[model samples]
Target: MDLTVLSYVIYLFISIVLTVWVARTLSRAGRVFLAQVFPGSEHLAEAVNHLLVVGFYLVNLGFVSLYLKSGATTETARQVFEGLSVKEGVVLLVLGGMHLGNVFVLNKLRSNSRRDFAVIPPIPPTGFLPEVEA
Candidate 1:
């Protein structure tokens, strides 16, 4: 096989493995976060977790497949390494951005939920207190 083919194989393998690992890690750690956001709803959290993971896989895998091609010909081993490094770096950066976006949205939901949880209005008294007898 050509060096370029070898590099492609290695890049695909590494990119996919990294994507799966990151997705699993986020899904596991995000349980507590989802639970908090949807307080008292374990099933909802689990369902949301599944959906998030599926979406993560779709987006990342699509990105990986789309970004798999290297315009530069891989003639040498050093070139392979450089190509792999650039692709992997971009993948990692995109993954991090996705993670941050999820957290930001979830945090916003949690904040809204907390704010809307009040049972009573916080209005002050409209009338003054009557004077007490001496």
Candidate 2:
């Protein structure tokens, strides 16, 4: 097999395995955070978590497929390793970015939810004011 082909195979395998592992880890751990953000809606949190995982897979896999092609042809073992490293690095970076983006958006949602549930002082009714003769 050509070095380039081997690199591509290894890259795809590693990238896919990493993606699945990360996705599962996030989904499992993020449920608590999602539940907190949703507040009294564990079902909704789970649903959202599932949807997020699906979307994550779609986007990341699409990126992986699109990025499969290497600019330079690999002939040597060193070149194969180098190519794999670069490709894997990009995949890792993309995964990290996606994870961060998800966390940022979820944090915003949690913050907003907290704000929505914040306590507010009640105002006195206008009609409760005593009338004074002029």
Candidate 3:
């Protein structure tokens, strides 16, 4: 096969792998954040993590399938960059921006969760209430 074909294949593979890996990492981190925010609800953290990963894969893989290119050229950086269409560049930039925003949001969520956990007290039993009747 030609070098373009090889490069395209490599790029696709790397992009998919990186996106999925980042998604999974974000899921786990989000779980930690949720654990802090929810106090006694650690199970919710795991559930949210799985749900986020599912959504990430669905959206990103859809983009990958739609935007993939098959051929490439061995040329200077300027030539290679110039060959890209405006639409393609915009799509890629949007995807990258989305990923960065996802990370930022997750980090903020984690920080807020830590703060919430720190301020809350443990739950008390319902029966622990004092008897008011004579």
Candidate 4:
């Protein structure tokens, strides 16, 4: 097999495996945070989590497939490793960025939800009403 073809295969395999692992990890752990963000709606949280995983797969896999092409010829072993490293590195960075974006948005939602449900003290009624004349 051509080294370039080998590199493409390796890159696709690693990218897909990493994406699925990260998505599953996030879905499992994020449920609690989502539940808190959408208090009294565990079902909604679960639904949102499932949707998120599906979207994640669609997006990351699309990116992986689109990014599969190597810019330079890969005739040598060193070139194959270099290509794989660069490709995988970019994939990792993209994954990290997506994770951070998700967390940032969810944290904002959680904060807003907390603020909406915050308790405020009521003010005491002010001084005396006028007496009525007989």
Give the whole-model CA lDDT for all candidates, comma-separated.
0.89, 0.90, 0.65, 0.89
Model 4 ranges with Cα > 4 A deviation = 127-134
**3 against 4, candidate with superior lDDT:** 4
What is the Cα-based TM-score of model 2? 0.88
Error of 2 at 60 (Å): 0.6
**Candidate 3, clashing residue pairs?**
none
lDDT of 3 by residue, 34-122 (tens): 67656687787777767767877778777767766634464654443444444345455656776787677667777887775577677
What tens-digit string does per-residue lDDT give for candidate 4 at 1-134? 99999999999999999999999888887787789889999899899889888988898899999999878999999999998999999999999988887778777878888888897889898998999999
Higher-scoring candidate on TM-score, 2 or 3:
2
Model 2: per-residue lDDT, tens digit, 1-134?
A: 88888898999999999999989988987887788888888889999999999999999999999999989988899999988888899999999999998888778888888888897989867776678999
Q: Is candidate 1 or candidate 4 better by TM-score?
A: 4
> Global CA lDDT of candidate 1, please?
0.89
Q: Across residues 1-134, which tens digit of lDDT does each residue of candidate 1 receive?
A: 99999998998999899989988988998887888878889999999989989999999999999998889999999999999999999999999988888778777877877777856877998999999999
As for model 4, its CA RMSD to the true structure in angstroms is 3.7
Q: What's the TM-score of each model vs. the native?
A: 0.87, 0.88, 0.56, 0.88
For each candidate in turn, give its C-alpha RMSD to the true structure in angstroms: 5.1, 2.8, 8.1, 3.7
lDDT value for candidate 4? 0.89
Worst 10 residues of 3 by lDDT: 79-88
Residue 73 CA error for candidate 1 (Å)? 0.6
